[model samples]
Target: MKGLTIQQMAIGDSATFTKTVSESDVYQFAGITGDFNPAHINEEYAKDTVFKTRIAHGMLSAGFISTVLGTRLPGPGTIYLRQELKFLAPVRIGDTITAKAEITGLVLEKNRVTLRTTCTNQEGVLVVDGEALMSPPKA
Candidate 1:
Protein backbone atom coordinates (compact mmCIF):
# COMPACT_ATOMS: atom_id res chain seq x y z
CA MET A 1 0.00 0.00 0.00
CA LYS A 2 2.65 2.43 -0.99
CA GLY A 3 0.07 4.64 -2.71
CA LEU A 4 -0.49 7.84 -0.84
CA THR A 5 -3.62 9.60 0.19
CA ILE A 6 -4.41 13.05 -1.09
CA GLN A 7 -3.27 14.62 2.14
CA GLN A 8 -0.08 12.63 2.09
CA MET A 9 0.87 13.15 -1.54
CA ALA A 10 3.34 15.82 -2.53
CA ILE A 11 3.61 17.49 -5.88
CA GLY A 12 6.69 15.50 -6.87
CA ASP A 13 5.78 12.10 -5.44
CA SER A 14 6.19 9.35 -8.01
CA ALA A 15 6.01 5.60 -8.57
CA THR A 16 6.82 3.06 -11.29
CA PHE A 17 6.25 -0.50 -12.48
CA THR A 18 8.09 -2.46 -15.16
CA LYS A 19 7.58 -5.58 -17.22
CA THR A 20 9.17 -7.17 -20.27
CA VAL A 21 6.68 -7.52 -23.09
CA SER A 22 6.28 -11.15 -24.04
CA GLU A 23 4.58 -12.98 -26.86
CA SER A 24 2.11 -14.35 -24.38
CA ASP A 25 1.30 -10.89 -23.15
CA VAL A 26 0.17 -9.80 -26.54
CA TYR A 27 -1.80 -12.95 -27.19
CA GLN A 28 -3.41 -12.95 -23.79
CA PHE A 29 -4.44 -9.35 -24.16
CA ALA A 30 -5.84 -10.07 -27.54
CA GLY A 31 -7.73 -13.04 -26.19
CA ILE A 32 -9.07 -11.18 -23.20
CA THR A 33 -10.14 -8.14 -25.19
CA GLY A 34 -10.93 -9.88 -28.44
CA ASP A 35 -8.74 -7.42 -30.32
CA PHE A 36 -7.22 -9.81 -32.83
CA ASN A 37 -6.09 -7.26 -35.31
CA PRO A 38 -3.61 -8.54 -37.88
CA ALA A 39 -1.07 -5.96 -36.81
CA HIS A 40 -0.96 -7.54 -33.39
CA ILE A 41 -1.48 -11.22 -34.19
CA ASN A 42 -0.67 -12.06 -37.78
CA GLU A 43 3.04 -12.20 -38.41
CA GLU A 44 2.63 -12.24 -42.15
CA TYR A 45 0.37 -9.26 -42.11
CA ALA A 46 2.56 -7.38 -39.64
CA LYS A 47 5.66 -8.07 -41.71
CA ASP A 48 4.19 -6.02 -44.51
CA THR A 49 3.23 -3.16 -42.23
CA VAL A 50 5.31 -0.25 -41.01
CA PHE A 51 6.47 -1.95 -37.87
CA LYS A 52 7.52 -5.08 -39.75
CA THR A 53 6.56 -7.23 -36.78
CA ARG A 54 3.79 -7.77 -34.30
CA ILE A 55 3.29 -5.06 -31.74
CA ALA A 56 1.82 -5.32 -28.33
CA HIS A 57 -1.50 -3.61 -27.78
CA GLY A 58 -1.09 -0.03 -26.65
CA MET A 59 -3.58 -0.48 -23.82
CA LEU A 60 -1.60 -3.39 -22.47
CA SER A 61 1.26 -1.06 -21.65
CA ALA A 62 -1.25 1.43 -20.27
CA GLY A 63 -2.38 -1.22 -17.85
CA PHE A 64 1.06 -1.08 -16.24
CA ILE A 65 0.35 2.53 -15.39
CA SER A 66 -2.85 1.47 -13.69
CA THR A 67 -0.89 -1.04 -11.66
CA VAL A 68 1.36 1.70 -10.39
CA LEU A 69 -1.50 4.02 -9.56
CA GLY A 70 -3.63 1.40 -7.88
CA THR A 71 -1.00 -0.58 -6.00
CA ARG A 72 2.09 1.58 -5.62
CA LEU A 73 1.45 5.31 -5.63
CA PRO A 74 -2.08 5.82 -4.39
CA GLY A 75 -2.21 2.14 -3.47
CA PRO A 76 -5.52 0.29 -3.20
CA GLY A 77 -8.98 1.82 -3.33
CA THR A 78 -7.90 4.53 -5.70
CA ILE A 79 -10.55 5.24 -8.32
CA TYR A 80 -9.36 6.17 -11.76
CA LEU A 81 -11.30 9.06 -13.20
CA ARG A 82 -9.78 10.02 -16.51
CA GLN A 83 -6.70 9.14 -18.54
CA GLU A 84 -5.22 10.73 -21.66
CA LEU A 85 -2.64 8.69 -23.55
CA LYS A 86 -0.40 9.22 -26.54
CA PHE A 87 1.04 6.09 -28.11
CA LEU A 88 4.41 7.39 -29.14
CA ALA A 89 6.10 4.21 -30.36
CA PRO A 90 5.46 0.57 -30.98
CA VAL A 91 6.14 -1.96 -28.23
CA ARG A 92 7.45 -5.17 -29.67
CA ILE A 93 7.87 -8.46 -27.86
CA GLY A 94 10.84 -8.60 -25.45
CA ASP A 95 10.82 -4.87 -24.97
CA THR A 96 11.03 -4.07 -21.31
CA ILE A 97 8.60 -1.29 -20.50
CA THR A 98 8.66 0.85 -17.40
CA ALA A 99 5.55 2.82 -16.55
CA LYS A 100 5.85 5.75 -14.20
CA ALA A 101 3.56 8.28 -12.55
CA GLU A 102 4.35 11.50 -10.76
CA ILE A 103 2.04 13.60 -8.70
CA THR A 104 2.00 17.00 -10.35
CA GLY A 105 -1.14 18.38 -8.74
CA LEU A 106 -3.35 17.59 -5.79
CA VAL A 107 -6.78 18.93 -5.05
CA LEU A 108 -7.22 18.24 -1.39
CA GLU A 109 -10.69 19.72 -1.27
CA LYS A 110 -11.90 17.20 -3.81
CA ASN A 111 -9.60 14.38 -2.79
CA ARG A 112 -8.29 14.28 -6.33
CA VAL A 113 -4.78 13.92 -7.66
CA THR A 114 -3.38 14.79 -11.06
CA LEU A 115 -0.53 12.61 -12.23
CA ARG A 116 1.80 12.77 -15.16
CA THR A 117 2.10 9.30 -16.64
CA THR A 118 4.65 7.83 -19.04
CA CYS A 119 6.07 4.57 -20.28
CA THR A 120 9.53 3.99 -21.66
CA ASN A 121 11.18 1.03 -23.36
CA GLN A 122 14.50 -0.71 -22.69
CA GLU A 123 16.20 1.43 -25.31
CA GLY A 124 15.22 4.51 -23.30
CA VAL A 125 12.72 5.56 -25.93
CA LEU A 126 9.44 6.79 -24.59
CA VAL A 127 6.63 4.62 -25.84
CA VAL A 128 3.73 6.38 -24.19
CA ASP A 129 2.96 9.61 -22.43
CA GLY A 130 -0.18 10.77 -20.70
CA GLU A 131 -1.95 12.33 -17.75
CA ALA A 132 -4.31 10.75 -15.31
CA LEU A 133 -6.91 12.09 -12.92
CA MET A 134 -7.72 9.97 -9.92
CA SER A 135 -9.47 9.91 -6.61
CA PRO A 136 -7.67 8.22 -3.77
CA PRO A 137 -9.74 6.74 -1.01
CA LYS A 138 -10.50 9.10 1.77
CA ALA A 139 -8.47 8.42 4.85
Candidate 2:
Protein backbone atom coordinates (compact mmCIF):
# COMPACT_ATOMS: atom_id res chain seq x y z
CA MET A 1 0.00 0.00 0.00
CA LYS A 2 1.27 3.48 -0.83
CA GLY A 3 0.97 6.55 1.38
CA LEU A 4 -2.14 8.71 0.93
CA THR A 5 -1.43 12.32 1.85
CA ILE A 6 -4.42 14.68 2.07
CA GLN A 7 -4.56 15.49 -1.64
CA GLN A 8 -6.00 12.28 -3.11
CA MET A 9 -9.62 12.64 -2.04
CA ALA A 10 -12.52 14.62 -3.39
CA ILE A 11 -15.74 15.72 -1.71
CA GLY A 12 -17.93 13.22 -3.56
CA ASP A 13 -15.76 10.10 -3.55
CA SER A 14 -16.99 6.80 -2.09
CA ALA A 15 -16.03 3.19 -1.41
CA THR A 16 -17.45 -0.16 -0.33
CA PHE A 17 -16.06 -3.35 1.18
CA THR A 18 -17.41 -6.62 2.56
CA LYS A 19 -16.49 -9.35 5.01
CA THR A 20 -18.13 -12.37 6.59
CA VAL A 21 -18.12 -12.70 10.34
CA SER A 22 -17.18 -16.17 11.53
CA GLU A 23 -17.04 -17.73 14.97
CA SER A 24 -13.28 -17.64 14.64
CA ASP A 25 -13.33 -13.95 13.87
CA VAL A 26 -15.37 -13.18 16.93
CA TYR A 27 -13.15 -15.31 19.10
CA GLN A 28 -9.98 -13.82 17.76
CA PHE A 29 -11.25 -10.29 18.12
CA ALA A 30 -12.35 -11.07 21.64
CA GLY A 31 -8.87 -12.35 22.45
CA ILE A 32 -7.09 -9.45 20.85
CA THR A 33 -9.35 -6.75 22.19
CA GLY A 34 -10.13 -8.40 25.52
CA ASP A 35 -13.84 -8.15 24.94
CA PHE A 36 -14.92 -11.62 25.99
CA ASN A 37 -18.51 -10.74 26.59
CA PRO A 38 -20.61 -13.91 26.68
CA ALA A 39 -22.96 -12.56 24.06
CA HIS A 40 -20.10 -12.78 21.62
CA ILE A 41 -19.10 -16.34 22.44
CA ASN A 42 -21.64 -18.35 24.42
CA GLU A 43 -24.66 -19.25 22.33
CA GLU A 44 -26.69 -20.25 25.34
CA TYR A 45 -25.89 -17.05 27.14
CA ALA A 46 -26.49 -15.05 24.03
CA LYS A 47 -30.00 -16.44 23.76
CA ASP A 48 -30.90 -14.39 26.81
CA THR A 49 -29.74 -11.18 25.19
CA VAL A 50 -32.08 -9.00 23.14
CA PHE A 51 -30.53 -10.37 19.96
CA LYS A 52 -31.55 -14.00 20.77
CA THR A 53 -28.14 -15.25 19.64
CA ARG A 54 -24.46 -14.50 19.84
CA ILE A 55 -23.64 -11.28 18.03
CA ALA A 56 -20.44 -9.66 16.89
CA HIS A 57 -19.19 -6.66 18.82
CA GLY A 58 -20.35 -3.30 17.59
CA MET A 59 -16.78 -2.10 17.28
CA LEU A 60 -15.96 -5.07 15.09
CA SER A 61 -18.50 -3.99 12.54
CA ALA A 62 -17.29 -0.42 12.77
CA GLY A 63 -13.76 -1.62 12.12
CA PHE A 64 -14.82 -2.29 8.56
CA ILE A 65 -15.01 1.46 8.09
CA SER A 66 -11.30 1.69 8.76
CA THR A 67 -10.67 -1.05 6.26
CA VAL A 68 -12.65 0.77 3.61
CA LEU A 69 -11.08 4.15 4.23
CA GLY A 70 -7.51 2.99 4.64
CA THR A 71 -7.41 0.45 1.85
CA ARG A 72 -9.91 1.46 -0.79
CA LEU A 73 -11.46 4.94 -0.83
CA PRO A 74 -8.45 6.96 0.12
CA GLY A 75 -6.06 3.99 0.25
CA PRO A 76 -3.03 3.69 2.56
CA GLY A 77 -1.84 6.29 5.10
CA THR A 78 -5.27 7.70 5.71
CA ILE A 79 -5.53 9.10 9.19
CA TYR A 80 -8.77 8.64 11.09
CA LEU A 81 -9.78 11.84 12.84
CA ARG A 82 -13.10 10.90 14.37
CA GLN A 83 -16.16 8.71 14.02
CA GLU A 84 -19.72 8.79 15.31
CA LEU A 85 -21.47 5.42 15.24
CA LYS A 86 -24.81 3.89 16.05
CA PHE A 87 -25.31 0.15 16.52
CA LEU A 88 -28.54 -0.44 14.70
CA ALA A 89 -28.73 -4.24 14.64
CA PRO A 90 -26.90 -7.36 15.64
CA VAL A 91 -24.25 -8.99 13.47
CA ARG A 92 -24.19 -12.76 13.74
CA ILE A 93 -21.78 -15.42 12.62
CA GLY A 94 -22.23 -16.27 8.94
CA ASP A 95 -23.53 -12.80 8.21
CA THR A 96 -21.84 -11.09 5.29
CA ILE A 97 -21.38 -7.42 6.11
CA THR A 98 -21.09 -4.81 3.39
CA ALA A 99 -19.70 -1.49 4.53
CA LYS A 100 -20.32 1.57 2.40
CA ALA A 101 -18.98 5.09 2.65
CA GLU A 102 -19.70 8.27 0.70
CA ILE A 103 -17.66 11.39 0.97
CA THR A 104 -19.75 14.27 2.23
CA GLY A 105 -17.34 17.11 2.84
CA LEU A 106 -13.79 18.22 2.34
CA VAL A 107 -12.16 20.64 4.74
CA LEU A 108 -9.43 22.01 2.55
CA GLU A 109 -7.73 24.07 5.22
CA LYS A 110 -7.83 21.24 7.77
CA ASN A 111 -7.10 18.62 5.13
CA ARG A 112 -9.98 16.48 6.36
CA VAL A 113 -12.85 14.67 4.71
CA THR A 114 -16.16 13.59 6.14
CA LEU A 115 -17.93 10.43 5.10
CA ARG A 116 -21.41 9.07 5.52
CA THR A 117 -20.96 5.47 6.52
CA THR A 118 -23.19 2.43 6.80
CA CYS A 119 -22.79 -1.30 7.18
CA THR A 120 -25.50 -3.71 6.07
CA ASN A 121 -25.78 -7.45 6.18
CA GLN A 122 -26.58 -9.86 3.37
CA GLU A 123 -30.21 -9.73 4.49
CA GLY A 124 -30.20 -6.02 3.70
CA VAL A 125 -30.45 -5.13 7.35
CA LEU A 126 -28.37 -2.21 8.51
CA VAL A 127 -26.10 -3.21 11.36
CA VAL A 128 -24.25 0.06 11.78
CA ASP A 129 -24.55 3.67 10.71
CA GLY A 130 -22.23 6.57 11.31
CA GLU A 131 -20.09 9.43 10.12
CA ALA A 132 -16.33 9.21 9.84
CA LEU A 133 -13.67 11.89 9.57
CA MET A 134 -10.40 11.14 7.83
CA SER A 135 -7.36 12.81 6.34
CA PRO A 136 -6.25 11.08 3.17
CA PRO A 137 -2.69 11.55 2.00
CA LYS A 138 -1.92 13.98 -0.83
CA ALA A 139 -1.75 12.45 -4.29
Candidate 3:
Protein backbone atom coordinates (compact mmCIF):
# COMPACT_ATOMS: atom_id res chain seq x y z
CA MET A 1 0.00 0.00 0.00
CA LYS A 2 1.13 3.53 -0.71
CA GLY A 3 1.99 5.81 2.20
CA LEU A 4 2.58 9.54 2.60
CA THR A 5 6.19 10.51 3.03
CA ILE A 6 7.08 13.02 5.70
CA GLN A 7 7.34 15.74 3.06
CA GLN A 8 3.85 15.00 1.84
CA MET A 9 2.24 15.67 5.21
CA ALA A 10 1.62 18.97 6.94
CA ILE A 11 0.51 20.26 10.28
CA GLY A 12 -3.30 20.09 10.73
CA ASP A 13 -3.63 17.20 8.24
CA SER A 14 -5.95 14.64 9.82
CA ALA A 15 -7.92 11.42 9.38
CA THR A 16 -10.56 9.41 11.17
CA PHE A 17 -11.80 5.83 11.55
CA THR A 18 -15.07 4.79 13.09
CA LYS A 19 -16.41 1.50 14.40
CA THR A 20 -19.22 0.22 16.57
CA VAL A 21 -17.91 -1.72 19.52
CA SER A 22 -19.48 -5.14 19.79
CA GLU A 23 -19.59 -7.98 22.30
CA SER A 24 -17.72 -10.19 19.88
CA ASP A 25 -15.03 -7.56 19.53
CA VAL A 26 -14.59 -7.44 23.29
CA TYR A 27 -14.37 -11.21 23.61
CA GLN A 28 -11.86 -11.46 20.79
CA PHE A 29 -9.64 -8.82 22.28
CA ALA A 30 -9.80 -10.47 25.68
CA GLY A 31 -8.94 -13.86 24.20
CA ILE A 32 -6.03 -12.55 22.17
CA THR A 33 -4.60 -10.53 25.06
CA GLY A 34 -5.52 -12.97 27.84
CA ASP A 35 -7.14 -10.09 29.71
CA PHE A 36 -10.34 -11.44 31.15
CA ASN A 37 -10.98 -8.65 33.57
CA PRO A 38 -14.52 -9.09 34.85
CA ALA A 39 -15.24 -5.45 33.95
CA HIS A 40 -14.74 -6.40 30.35
CA ILE A 41 -16.07 -9.94 30.18
CA ASN A 42 -18.53 -10.31 33.00
CA GLU A 43 -21.64 -8.18 32.91
CA GLU A 44 -23.00 -9.55 36.18
CA TYR A 45 -19.73 -8.85 37.96
CA ALA A 46 -19.50 -5.39 36.47
CA LYS A 47 -22.76 -4.37 38.14
CA ASP A 48 -20.80 -3.74 41.32
CA THR A 49 -18.31 -1.41 39.67
CA VAL A 50 -18.38 2.33 39.12
CA PHE A 51 -19.22 1.82 35.46
CA LYS A 52 -22.29 -0.19 36.51
CA THR A 53 -21.85 -2.38 33.43
CA ARG A 54 -19.17 -4.12 31.49
CA ILE A 55 -16.93 -1.69 29.58
CA ALA A 56 -14.76 -2.33 26.57
CA HIS A 57 -11.06 -2.49 27.29
CA GLY A 58 -9.37 0.88 27.05
CA MET A 59 -6.74 -0.58 24.72
CA LEU A 60 -9.44 -1.43 22.26
CA SER A 61 -10.10 2.27 21.78
CA ALA A 62 -6.40 2.95 21.56
CA GLY A 63 -6.23 0.49 18.68
CA PHE A 64 -8.51 2.76 16.74
CA ILE A 65 -5.88 5.49 16.93
CA SER A 66 -3.44 3.01 15.47
CA THR A 67 -5.88 2.35 12.69
CA VAL A 68 -5.98 6.02 11.72
CA LEU A 69 -2.22 6.30 11.73
CA GLY A 70 -1.45 3.02 10.00
CA THR A 71 -4.14 3.21 7.37
CA ARG A 72 -4.87 6.88 6.87
CA LEU A 73 -2.60 9.69 8.00
CA PRO A 74 1.03 8.56 7.56
CA GLY A 75 -0.65 5.60 5.88
CA PRO A 76 1.01 2.21 5.34
CA GLY A 77 4.63 1.51 6.31
CA THR A 78 4.65 4.14 9.04
CA ILE A 79 6.83 3.18 11.98
CA TYR A 80 5.18 3.96 15.28
CA LEU A 81 7.70 5.47 17.68
CA ARG A 82 5.77 6.35 20.82
CA GLN A 83 2.33 7.01 22.22
CA GLU A 84 0.81 8.54 25.37
CA LEU A 85 -2.86 7.93 26.14
CA LYS A 86 -5.43 9.03 28.67
CA PHE A 87 -8.68 7.15 29.10
CA LEU A 88 -11.32 9.82 29.51
CA ALA A 89 -14.50 7.77 29.54
CA PRO A 90 -15.94 4.28 29.24
CA VAL A 91 -16.80 2.62 25.95
CA ARG A 92 -19.80 0.38 26.13
CA ILE A 93 -20.75 -2.30 23.67
CA GLY A 94 -22.64 -0.90 20.65
CA ASP A 95 -21.16 2.57 21.02
CA THR A 96 -19.94 3.92 17.72
CA ILE A 97 -16.49 5.42 18.20
CA THR A 98 -14.65 7.70 15.84
CA ALA A 99 -10.88 7.77 16.21
CA LYS A 100 -9.08 10.82 14.86
CA ALA A 101 -5.44 11.73 14.30
CA GLU A 102 -4.17 15.15 13.32
CA ILE A 103 -0.67 16.15 12.43
CA THR A 104 0.77 18.46 15.07
CA GLY A 105 4.46 18.67 14.28
CA LEU A 106 7.06 17.25 11.93
CA VAL A 107 10.79 16.74 12.04
CA LEU A 108 11.89 16.61 8.43
CA GLU A 109 15.48 15.65 9.18
CA LYS A 110 14.36 12.56 11.05
CA ASN A 111 11.29 11.82 8.91
CA ARG A 112 9.20 12.00 12.06
CA VAL A 113 5.68 13.29 12.67
CA THR A 114 3.84 14.15 15.83
CA LEU A 115 0.08 13.66 16.04
CA ARG A 116 -2.78 14.51 18.34
CA THR A 117 -5.05 11.48 18.71
CA THR A 118 -8.53 11.11 20.09
CA CYS A 119 -11.57 8.86 20.13
CA THR A 120 -15.11 9.97 20.70
CA ASN A 121 -18.28 7.96 21.23
CA GLN A 122 -21.59 8.35 19.40
CA GLU A 123 -22.72 10.89 21.93
CA GLY A 124 -19.64 12.99 21.17
CA VAL A 125 -18.11 12.19 24.53
CA LEU A 126 -14.36 12.00 24.36
CA VAL A 127 -13.38 8.50 25.39
CA VAL A 128 -9.65 8.57 24.72
CA ASP A 129 -7.00 11.20 24.04
CA GLY A 130 -3.29 11.00 23.34
CA GLU A 131 -0.27 11.91 21.27
CA ALA A 132 1.81 9.73 18.97
CA LEU A 133 5.20 9.94 17.35
CA MET A 134 5.80 8.13 14.08
CA SER A 135 8.19 7.77 11.15
CA PRO A 136 6.43 8.26 7.86
CA PRO A 137 7.44 6.23 4.82
CA LYS A 138 10.59 7.37 3.05
CA ALA A 139 10.14 9.98 0.32
Best by lDDT: 3
lDDT of 3: 0.97
In order of TM-score, best first, we have 3, 1, 2
Q: How much lDDT does each candidate structure score?
A: 0.94, 0.88, 0.97
TM-score of each: 0.97, 0.93, 0.99
After superposition on all C-alphas, the RMSD of every candidate to the true structure, in Å, is 1.0, 1.5, 0.5
| Backbone Cα, N, C clashes tallied per candidate | 3, 8, 0
Please say which candidate is ahead in TM-score: 2 or 3.
Answer: 3
After superposition, the stretches of candidate 2 with alpha carbons farther than 4 Å from their true spots are 3-7
Question: After TM-score superposition, what is the CA distance of residue 137 in candidate 2 from its true location, in Å?
Answer: 0.8
Q: Which ten residues in a row have the lowest lDDT in candidate 1?
A: 1-10
TM-score of 1: 0.97
lDDT of 1 by residue, 14-128 (tens): 9999999999999999999999999999999999999999999999999999999999888898999999999999999999999999999999999999999999999999999
lDDT of 1 at 105: 94
- After superposition, candidate 1 runs with Cα above 4 Å error: none
Sequence-dependent TM-score of model 3: 0.99
